[model samples]
Target: MKKILAVLAVGMISSMAHAATVGSQSYKDNIEVGGSMWIPFGPHADSAGLPGVGVKGVALGQLSKISMRSVRKLTEQNPDYGATDGNNVTVVTPPAHGKVAMGNFNFAQLADSNAEVYYGEWTAHNDTAGATRSVYYVGKDKTANMPTSGTATYAVKGINQYSGNNQLNGTFTADFGKNTLKGSLANNALNVGVDAKINTAAASFNGSATAAGKTGTSQGHFFGNNAGSLAGFAKFDDRKLDTAFGGVKK
Candidate 1:
């Protein structure tokens, strides 16, 4: 019993090290494939990573604090969905959009023979009025982490945009497997090399893939923690965008 408690304590500490996210956003429809309309959490324009952080980190705490508002179920003829549960529900994982998972995803590939991996998901968030949406810290749990080292090729959808202040919202498209991302791994971090070939201007941010304001020639650095997830910041060319991302392994 004592040993079990000790292990649980260690796990909790490790989870804290990897940016913390404590809230759930459920979805009656999957936001990855554009099945349902987007939902708003916390503020209309929130960051992407941890609360009060420089990067466009998600304000999970703030999101959890927002007052619930009633939403009309489009599927139903005329039923008030009542008020939402704020950010305190099991999240619905986003679907895969082309090569990229519409939801926020993170991986940690160890420098070993077999790649050990874990991941999680959160339903995408959106604000129609602001035309903004997001998905970060999917699963929002830290126990599930993956390992990715060396040259690792995966898919990532669209791009993130961060104003001088904070992130607008999490966003992606419905073209499953449309974009692929490549990253090089170190002992504790993965350096996602920017593909200059990708037309940043053509790529999307919080909504349309063809949207503008896309920059070029940039990289993302994701650091791992004992909790089995990764959180990192990103910057684009011409300083057009900056973002902090967190996700679980697949």
Candidate 2:
């Protein structure tokens, strides 16, 4: 009997590799939340490759619930990436822009977090597209710190626009456990003609994102007086999980 069917196919490949190594070690010991995030608003071009001035629209949302709690752990990778290590991520917007709210809080440790590293702060408020209100404050200190292996390097500041205009400043850095994320932006006179026509700019942007899918790409550049100076780029070609209690969730 063909050696007992090759020992039942090697015991079903050793029980599927012990159930994927016990589901990646129980996704690194619990604190596993779900995911869904999408950000797209029209008339674009504040920087990073310009080009979107045709007034379109698309700003969908759904993060229904995102919770994670796994404190203390200096090693043993994969706990849902340490429940997004030093977690704090909020995005609730759905009422056609007027229901805008954004947040990012880590307070400390997130280059990759090997311990003794800090830099994190981001807050944003909004009222989508036909803008009526907007606000943003950002931070990421710890210029450079290293305790013999627990690396660090960060610098960022912020002030956003749309509430009387003219206010946009940004900076970036990363290197904790190195899943990498970068940034850059500068603006001070973007009064798009109401007879004020002011436009001064400086831009450099980078992108790399991951959770399961929907890759990344972003680029920008735009110069003053609008006589022509623009560049743009964007790519995140795949992501789908629609559920208003219907079907689709994968």
Candidate 3:
């Protein structure tokens, strides 16, 4: 019986590995469309020591070619990694000119929970040395434990899509009683403000954002003990900017 159980365990591991390998190609193709790649959004635990960090980069002509090959390979290795429309991946560095600048969150890992979202970066290179980097977050919502009436502030990190992955730092405020959320993420290049309605049962929020007289939409979710953390993604309709942001309650 012991030997049988051991063999079954091994088989299960092997089957999972095979599925991941087979699924990666399809997932990559689905996410990368017309020079745009999907990124996951929502609250995530800072597992792997990589809390979500904002990135800034320049767009080079070689970005599309390099990122496609690199991201596919990374997905092949991390079958569990996935992407969604909430955010996007922008290729930054070109390898021929210099070594790709590595960032703090430079590798992909499996999500810590059944519900998942991801953050990522890329390195441009012609050879196999080029690769995409990513991290996963567990999405959690403790509705019962969530405070019914109160206001809290969260410090956030933002990625500016219009300004070559411009990094925006800012804060968000949530009012539980009002079922409303508001915040602004900004840098010298741009500033965006968001207002949304919160759905406590789902531990999520969605609404509109405005920047420089242009309007956009935002969506995100709450995470952790009693919904103590929040994260979101946004995009402008007329402006070339998109953003991802998150922070913990203080």
Residue-level lDDT of model 1, residues 109-189, one tens digit each, is 122122122111222233223222322222222222323222223333222332222212232112213333323211111
* Clash count, one per candidate: 30, 13, 0
- Candidate 3 lands at a TM-score of 0.50
Better of 2 and 3 by lDDT: 3
* Model 2 lDDT, full chain set: 0.21
TM per candidate comes to: 0.24, 0.17, 0.50
Candidate 3's C-alpha runs over 4 A off are: 1-144, 162-166
Ranking by lDDT, best first?
3, 1, 2
Name the candidate, 1 or 2, with the larger TM-score value: 1
Q: What lDDT does the true structure give each of the candidates?
A: 0.25, 0.21, 0.46
Query: Candidate 3 local accuracy as lDDT?
Result: 0.46
Question: Which 10 consecutive residues of model 3 have the lowest summed lDDT?
Answer: 18-27
RMSD of each: 16.4, 22.4, 12.4
Better structure of 2 and 3 per TM-score: 3
Candidate 2 residue lDDT tens string, 29-110: 1111121111122221021111100101212122111111111121113232223321222122223333223221222222
Better of 1 and 3 by TM-score: 3
Candidate 3, residue 216: lDDT: 78
Candidate of highest TM-score:
3
Return the lDDT, model 2, position 26.
9
* Model 2 misplaced stretches (Cα beyond 4 Å): 1-202, 220-234, 239-250
